[model samples]
Target: MGDRVYLNVLASRFRAQLSYRTSFVLDFVAQMLGQGGELVAILVLFGRTEELGGFAAHEVLIMYGIAGVAFGIADLVIGQLDDLPRLIRTGQLDVMLLRPLSPLAQIATGDIQLRRVGRVATGLAVLVTVLSTSDIAWSFPKLLLAFTAPLVGAVIFGSVWVVACSVCFWIVDGRELANTVTYGSNMFTSYPITVYPSWLRRLLAFVIPGAFVAYYPALALLDRPDPLGAPAFLGWCAPLAALAAAGVAGLVWRFAIRHYQGTGS
Candidate 1:
């Protein structure tokens, strides 16, 4: 019942966006171009250097593809949480609290932007192109990891989105700060973490676990050892990282909601 309501609301919003066909097309193209520009930058860098952070061009593309797809899915789904400040400021959150459905669920499903599928498409194209052209050792486990990595990465990113946006309950204007975590994580994971210095790499890898989003998975798929000297098995730990992130996100969201007082607007 609750799931059905969420799905229905998402479907309605998706259809509403599609109603503006021209606007939707332009939005979709703009999203693709915006993300595609990053890919172009990666290619241009490779033109000048044989390797980036000791990674070949194709290897970095794998990271980009995974990060792009994962972030696109996260942005398409939970990205609306960025609007929490507006909801709080306008007292809309108070009305949400009176509803039977979970406020978080309502906020997540309130808007479904189908145009963001453009980013997913862009990533998928790159993933398919690279996988077909690159000389990866194909095996059952590698194939399974390839398919599952993006989904797991999406979960990790979504949890970060929730946890970061929950700060709105207190600050009510913390969207920019939250973007540093959410969008910044996406940019960080889209490249080999080796490109970053040791301190920043450690922060992304352990503190935020952004490396699990794409870097480790790409290494796993490539059957390469971690140059940072981490254990080989760390590549398979994205699911565990995602679970931990989700747990923290849930706790923080619940704590925030429990302590929330209306803005008195």
Candidate 2:
């Protein structure tokens, strides 16, 4: 029943989005231009430099592709988290809590950002291009990793988005600041992790687990080593890292929900 409700909500969102055809197309184009500009910048950078840190251009492109696909899928599913502040500020969250369905599920499936499809398509294009052109030898594990990696990444990113929105339970109006976590982390993950300073790297790895969502997994997939001296096995730990982050975020989200004081609307 819960699953059926979620699907119905998702379908309604799709139909509603379709109602705004011009706006939808403009949104799609705007997102494409934004993402395309980033890709162009990365390519231009590689064209000038032999490599960024120790990673070659194509390798970094794979990293970009990984981050893009992961974040794109996550943004598509959970983009409502970014608007959580508005919901809280407008007191619409009361309506959500009153529903028989789960509040988190309601928020996630309540609205779909179809513009994110542009970004996902761009990432898949990058992935296909890199996979075809790059000469990395593939193994069975690697092949399996290719399929499952993005889904794991989406989960990890979605976990981060949830935690960011959970803060809205307390600071309803000012929660837009949480975009630093979502967009900031997404920007950071789009490049080779080795290029960043050691302290920054450790912060991203240990504090936010951003490394797991992209860098560590990409390293393992590409069979690359960390110059700042992380273990080779850290790459294989991506799934565990995601689970740890998601677990913590889930706990925080639940606690926040329990502590929620309505906007008194």
Candidate 3:
């Protein structure tokens, strides 16, 4: 019953977005253009140099593709959670708690934005373009990693979103700080982590685990060694990283919800 309710709410939200055809089209195009600009920037950088942090242009594109697709999916699904502060300030969350459905599910499915699919499509196009032209030594495991990497990356990013957004329950105005983790991490992971200084690299890799989102998986897919001297098998540990992040997000979310004190409006 809960699953059915969630799906119905999601479907209705999706349909509502499509109802505004002109606005939807414009937003969709804007999303694609915004994402395309990032891709173009990567191309321009590579034009000036053959390699970035020891990664060739096409190799970095693999990272961009995977990170782009993953972040797009995460944004489309739960980006609405960023609005929690507004909802809290308005006391609308009181209404949500009165409902039988899970509050997290309600918030996530409440305002589904179909236009974000444009970003996902853009990323997928890059992924396909590079996958076709790159000289990857494809095998069964490699093929599986290529197929699963984006999904795993999505989980990692989504978990980061949830854990970060949970801060609204405390600060009520921490979305900017949260974005430094959610959106900031997306930009950080889109390129080779090798380019970053050692301290920043370690922070992204160990502290935030953004490197597991796409960087490590790209290495696994490309059959390249980690430039940082980590084992090759660490590339395949993305699932573990996703699971760990999800666990932390779950705990943080539950704790925040328990401590939530309405605005008393």
Expressed as tens digits, the lDDT of each residue in 179-244 for candidate 1 is: 999999988998999999999998988888899999999998998999888888989999999999
Off by over 4 Å in 2: 19-23
* Runs with alpha carbons beyond 4 Å of true place in candidate 3: none
Better candidate number, 1 or 2, judged by TM-score: 1
Native-referenced Cα lDDT, model 2:
0.82
lDDT of 3 by residue, 89-142 (tens): 999888998899888888998887899998888989999999989998999989
State residue 29's C-alpha deviation in candidate 2, in Å: 2.9
What TM-score does model 1 achieve against the real structure?
Answer: 0.98
Off by over 4 Å in 1: none
Error of 1 at 89 (Å): 0.5
Question: Ten consecutive residues with minimal summed lDDT in candidate 2?
Answer: 168-177
Assess candidate 3 and give its lDDT.
0.91
